[model samples]
Target: MPYVNIKVTDESVNAEQKRQLIEGATHLLVTVLNKDPATTHVVIDLVPTDNWGVSGKSVTRLRQQQVKEAIQAQAERRAQEQ
Candidate 1:
């Protein structure tokens, strides 16, 4: 038996996407490793952005920081152009 675990942020995925992911993962194992689809298990775990961390900050925080940086950069470009 082969088990595959896939983790994705819970913010954007929908039911159809999840179904595709499960099917795709199973197909990958069947095609690449010649594993039987009947015996392959694919698990999808969705973690909240606040619960998922990177560089000591939550994913939500990271995204906010990125947005702030992008806005600041855009302002800087406008200032330079003026």
Candidate 2:
């Protein structure tokens, strides 16, 4: 089982966003996390932006640098804020 608590912005969350996170996390459990889809469990929880950081920078201090670029891109395209 894999439990993933994703800290994201309240300004950047939605139902489809939640679904995408869950799906993506589940995929990770099966792929990167090395869990078998048939026997694994996955859970997702959304936290406020205050709880997330990127490359040593807190969400509030976001600088839009390369390190946060992919993650930010994912959020924009997937409706998520991870």
How badly does each model clash, as a count of residue pairs?
0, 0
Best by TM-score: 1
Q: 25, model 2: CA deviation in Å?
A: 0.6
Encode model 2's per-residue lDDT on 1-82: one tens digit a residue.
Answer: 6666675565567789788877887888888868877665555556555677767776665744555887878779887544
**lDDT for 40 (candidate 1):** 98
Give the Å shift of residue 36 in candidate 2: 3.2
Q: TM-scores of the models, in the given order?
A: 0.88, 0.46
Best by lDDT: 1
Clash pairs for candidate 1: none
Q: Write the residue-wise lDDT of candidate 1 on 1-82 in tens digits.
A: 7999999888889999999999999999999999999999999999999999989999999999999999999999999999
lDDT scores in order? 0.95, 0.69
Candidate 1 lDDT for residue 41: 94
